[model samples]
Target: MVNKILCATRNGIGGEIVQVQANFVRALPAFVITGLANSSIQESKQRIQSALHHIGFHFPALKIAINLAPADLAKSGSHFDLPIALLIALHKKGIDTQEWFAFGELALDGTLTYNDNIYPLLLEIALRHQNAKVILPTSGQELFCHLPHLQIYYASSLQEALQILESPESTPAKTQTTLNFDTIHIGDTDYYYEREFPLDFIEVKGQEIAKRAALIAASGFHNILYEGSPGCGKSMIAKRLRYILPPMSLEEMIESVKLQALSAQKPSYTPLRPFRSPHQSASKSSILGSATQNEAKPGEIALAHQGILFFDELPHFGKEVLESLREPLENNELVVSRVHSKISYPTAFLFVGAQNPCPCGNLLSPSKECRCTPKDISSYKSRLSEPFLDRIDLFVQMQENEQDPKPSLDSATMQQMVFHAFSAQKQRGQSRLNGKLSEREVEEICILDDATQRILLQARERFNLSHRAIQKLKKLSRTIADLDNAKDIAKSHFLEALSYRYIS
Candidate 1:
């Protein structure tokens, strides 16, 4: 009789259920694992054997075959060890079978080890099988306790797991009875940073117009670009922008955590959105994700999903790396393709780029002279493609001013405005931020008044704006209207949206 056990595996940030089948045949003593499993799964034979031996169950002197059913599916990761060992143990004891989903790694001493991938896999199973019960290492119980629906059993060792399976009246797993939406509210919790961020907009002494642009970007989740002289507070404003951005909801937090769980980074339970600032020297593959052999991994853009991706010194970044962002910027997702596999990941984030107006970093400053000729400035600006610039909603040019100016909108005040805008978007049933609206959604939701339409027509005719640019302008204007809680787009909204367009 063949013994069977249930397990789960990864399929490019997604999860798939797998069946482990064990059989004892009449032949020379040998252990074999048959499937499209990689080396990580194949090496589990030794770990499983040792773990069983440590628990006083030696394999019988017979040929043992373990088949991971649906064999065509490729299996990777060390999580196969626990399920394989359980199947073999039950086979040796002539025990029939029980429907249970098991996933973990088995140490040589028969201890169950935790793997971070369980969160996503278990989440998938919970959705597909509502009454599913999963057995995992005790260390992971707290990590997934927030998922109240799934029944999760945590065990410390192989001995404990076997005892629980053998017992007729084992205690049921503990679950969270009450949701924690109100506990540790986003308004009360600090942002997810290691240390206190002492740099606030107040520290940025000048460029009042630039500060206004940053506030608007945060309120609507719009992408913004800053070009000006070095030390003109471009990067300073970008860094502080995150502090004033709105907090995430429970659903957004879960989605963001699911993406983070796919990467090697330890998952965070906080509602604070992620902030990723990849250096300009990063390769295209590193920023946009890649597939090697059969394993597909997420890149920095995917890591920054549902958060902020700030690029300082934008022109210094690789051209290919910058261009690769165009698709994700428009579609709110990234698709990475290899010779044999393709994987898609969420890339919805607020982009903030800062760069100097020219190579000399003094072209727009009145206090300094720009040594670079017009050709140098033109070439520097050309590094950012026209299509790429179109995707960005707001463009501000900053210059060094001799007079010190007081900051108008502080972080707390700006965050409140963003929070209000977020409420408006939620009431409208938009699943995404205002900046990520599709063209169809823009047409459906962004209704322009007659006066606003006239202004839009004039701007398009005078600037020779493309159809795509007009669509983007409508989305931008919609966000501006949302900020003011307006029922319709006014002339001021249309004019403000037009002012952010590219300047020749």
Candidate 2:
């Protein structure tokens, strides 16, 4: 009988199950793996060869052929080693690996292990093939403990695996992951921070208006831009915004985990929202993803889904890269079209950008003299086109020593306002945050009185705001009203929303 066992391979955001088919023929002894396996998978031959031998498996001279089925798609990862080894060693034992899938990397000595990189692919299996039985490394059993329906068996070594496969009916299922949406926190409670924010709003020394703008941005999930001289607390405020933003749902936590797992960085699986601050030097391909004929890779924007993407020294970035932010900023999702396939990735994130008013970093400083010429400042400002600037929901101009001697707002305090606003929106049955309201939803939630509507029209004409600008303004007003616990968008809220629209 032909021995068959299934394993996983990443296919875009999802995965594919590859069947390891082993055929032992009576011929000259040789081991071969076919079907476009990568060098890592190819290198697994010696490891698996030694492992089966070390586990006391020695056979008469025969040709051992292993082919990863569905040969059209290329496969990688050493996790393929275990299933292939199992198929080769257990064909005579008549063990039915067809009942479940297996995944793990093998050492020459027969130990089994995997990494967080496999977590997402494993999750894809859980999502697509619900109630599927899977045998994964015991090392990551905790990763799946909370997931129900799917049964898992953890094996740490080749010997341990043999014992389990020998008595399949008696082996118990392993622990799975359980996602808790209710264990949410604003800053320091139930959730975890990858690193403690060393600076607080209380330590910022000044710029209370900028802090208020930050609070509104956090409460509404609004895109914000900051123009100030260097060291003007712009970066400091952006850093603290994630912790103070609305609490995440269980779905968001899982999405965050998947995004990080797909990237080069390791997944933290924390409830804390992501805060991705890519430097100005990052490439367009790095900010937006890149795709080949067979694969698509996520960029900084996709990686920042359900969280924050901060650009410091925004003007210094490439014009193409800066303009590329338009798609995600406008539609909240990116549609990447290539020759063979079109793929979509979530780009829902709060885009926070900070730049000096001028290249010399002193144009807006009251204490320091302006060294940049008018033309120089104009060119520097031109880096951010009008279209791009119009997309920003909140724009704050920070002045030197507009700074207070002491800080007043803290993250906990801001989080309280954000949480209150969040509760207000939810109480009103709003499905999305204020910043993400659709045009129809904006009309539904943003209730402006006659006077407030007149002021909005007047401000729209005065500022020459586009329809999108008006919609964003309404959302901002709605957010301000929510923070104030007011039902209607008051005149003060409308004017306050308009005040932050201009760079001045």
Best by lDDT: 2
lDDT of 1 by residue, 1-504 (tens): 888888888887778889888889999999999989889999998888899999999789999998887899888888888888888777757554447888889899999988877778887887788877677888777676766467677788888877766776766587654343333233323222212244577677767878878877877788899988888888889888877776665556667777777877788676557888999988888899887655677888998887789999999999898899999998989988777788998888999999998999988888788899989989998999988988898999887863355446666666667777766776777776678888788888888988888888988889888887888788788888888888788889888888887755
How do the residues 37-66 of candidate 2 rate in per-residue lDDT, one tens digit apiece? 989899999999898989898864888888
lDDT of 1: 0.80
lDDT of each: 0.80, 0.81
**Count of clashing pairs, candidate 1:** 0
lDDT of 2 at 106: 89
Model 2 residue 187 CA deviation in Å: 20
Which 10 successive residues of model 1 have the least lDDT summed? 187-196
Q: Tell me how many residue pairs clash in candidate 2.
A: 10
- RMSD (CA, Å), candidate 1 to true, equals 3.1
